[model samples]
Target: MKTSSFYVAFDEAHKPRGKIAGNYSHLKEFLDSQGFICQPYMEFPITRQNLSPYDILVIPCPDFAKFSTNEIDAIAQWVKEDGGGLLALSHAGGDKGRRSNLSELVEKFGLSFENDQVLDYSKNFGLENLPEVVNFSPPHPITEGITSLCFRAGCSLSTVGLNVVPVAISNEESDPFSTPLIVTAEVQEGRVVAIGSYEMFRNEIPGGFEQPGHQEFCSNIFQWLKTEYREKVKTGEIKPKVTIQEPTQNYDANGITANVGSQPSFISAKLNLSSHIVISDKSDLANLFHGLLDEVTVLKDQIKTVIETIVSSEEQILETQKATESAEAATPLELPPNIEPLPVPEPERLTEMPEKPKSMKDTKKKTDTHLPKTKTHQPQPIPDPLPMTKEEIEVELETLKNKLNSIENLKDLVESKYKNKSYTKAQYEKQIERLSNDLNRSLNRIKELEMQYTKGKK
Candidate 1:
């Protein structure tokens, strides 16, 4: 098999529902056959320094979590400056369905995922979730030679900037006919592709890798996504926007530059505490300390969960990866006939997502609080509910608590930025209001979870 320098990283830090080797081994194998190196990105905080080595980053459906503001900025900046390729994938019903905020990150590239699944009853592959789509728009490299392909249980997408283009659409027979299903962008020196369905790349599943034209389409996507800019960075042609190399100070508890430095003594170090941030009084400083402590707690829980997931799944993950080595020998799992009744996706609970704020320093808006709410929840599909274990319930509760902590930390960080006048009053108000809504939603969701747990116990 031929190989190339194009490196692809599948993010594993944010609790993605699909593991590369476990669920996307087919994708890994395909990319490998094309000479691309694939690896799981498990680095925490997602700093530019950590991402500098790769040409492409793929986020495969983060579940029940939100990427921190710092991490999002890092990713966005990496793609725009370092010639990185970002391929953020989501499932049916989009971010709202998964209880995640991937659209938040991809919006930086002028594309957003919709909260509706594409369904075609008349034109499907044995089932409605497996929508047979053949719509290709004005010729684009990514859609080259791709006539028909399986959309496979995925949501839709919308584009904004002129640089961003939609290459594929839903058939007139499907729900929301002709809407964008795959959006791409030429952002600065980098490239971005956002697709709603990650399932199409799975191994031995209906509407998956075996879907006739899928392999050809996959080749086109990778060939287009493998940006030449990564090679530029290697030859010292450009510098990354993130400046972590010089004097290192990873994100402080506030996810911003702080007084903390790696230097041994304060005399030679660049002191940021007294210079940049205006701590009105001792009380404010105390509050900062308290916020740091809370942040520490959140980080601890995050690390614990990541470690536990790795330890628990280590063996299985390795076996799955090893299984890929002998893939040619293994007979593909026979896809079952579509006799099983179509599983109804949970009714989508829609949230009014505010239009993307034009600028980070955007002026005060006329209305901030009463804005529409948006959500994407992968319903407990129409299939029979599986029995839940006590451990599962406990883990869920912990996850909810951790999310609450993260929101609080984000609130504090934004407020601190406001205090320093880094954000306009309007920007601050808008962020705080959104964070407030997130807090309430997380609280309500916790109650709902507890009730379900109790009902199960009974």
Candidate 2:
């Protein structure tokens, strides 16, 4: 059994829309399965003293409450000086719509949430708000193995140069082109990640935690966030304590129940933490049965809370409303189906289609000269009789090399799709065969050009 080493705290104060016991229960369960200690911090006015016990702090979109400047400064100090990981999530329309100030807290680390929702009408899961993102630029750790992600009713993020960077971005067809969907920064000794969409890892939906790349994305972000500072925290290298009192609650390893006027809770799926006891006789068996009955009672309450949160989930509808408004505002210029806008008119106008030659005898009387000559296309370029110059050889060689580069790039793209399981074995092998043939031909042509160019130079 993997012992819990890394401590993770979910900020439940300031009235966050999601919590461990409710909308985010699945996320809590997943982390618990990984053997991480998950808890909720319900303490008010988040201070450095209140944050000392944990290695990572996740603030999942405070609804309408704003964090005090002092609290923000303390959180920043903890991350920079003491080496703690910070993950902040926000919805669409950002601070203004949510009536919160998460941007101010994250701005200290060169990241901020934008007042916008990402939408792609051409590509999505039934609606424009759920934009499917395939573009991962510059290849950072958070997006390492992610091929695609659904940014469900989320906003976009902005980052400053160098210190902060975007790992994932929206598709080309999205409203905001190539804007950052996920941003990360490494400040001093700690790490910070800000995501526009919190629902990207929410319990269950089309573009929820079950999305193909999202689980891997969560793993990557957490692994990167667990810095050397966290390692030291585990080793007891530094003994920083939370001086402020934390709300106490029983840790239910199986049930993972957390509620208001309650501490945040997560179930231990991997770590079977229930106290071990030997059932030597009838008395021990009776005691175990009593405990199991008690567990069933707690689970019922947890289920009730989960249902309530789901119904109340996104009460403001800030992200969805904002996304809808954006969609309505930007109505695409779509032409009627099956007809494309033509820049130039066809060769012959509609009236000039040869008149159908009234009859065969009339067509025979009409000379072939009336018909337009169909020009024959030649695939190969006509050769010059004169000997070629070295400059011309150099130009041809460069062009052939460029063709070879294009072929190689296509090969890499196909291989990546196969590795990600996006392509079937048969499709992969067939494409590889065709691309390999093209690849060999390009290589041979380039080789011939190089030889000709060299001989010409000589």
Off by over 4 Å in 1: 1-4, 235-458
Displacement of the residue 418 alpha carbon in candidate 1, Å? 49
* Model 2 lDDT, residue 5, Cα: 72
Give the alpha-carbon lDDT of every model.
0.72, 0.73
lDDT of 1 at 162: 37
After superposition, the stretches of candidate 2 with alpha carbons farther than 4 Å from their true spots are 1-4, 236-249, 253-458
Residue 42 lDDT (model 1): 61
TM-score of each candidate structure, all chains considered together: 0.53, 0.55
* Backbone clashes (count) for model 2: 0
Please state the error at residue 419 of candidate 2 in Å.
40
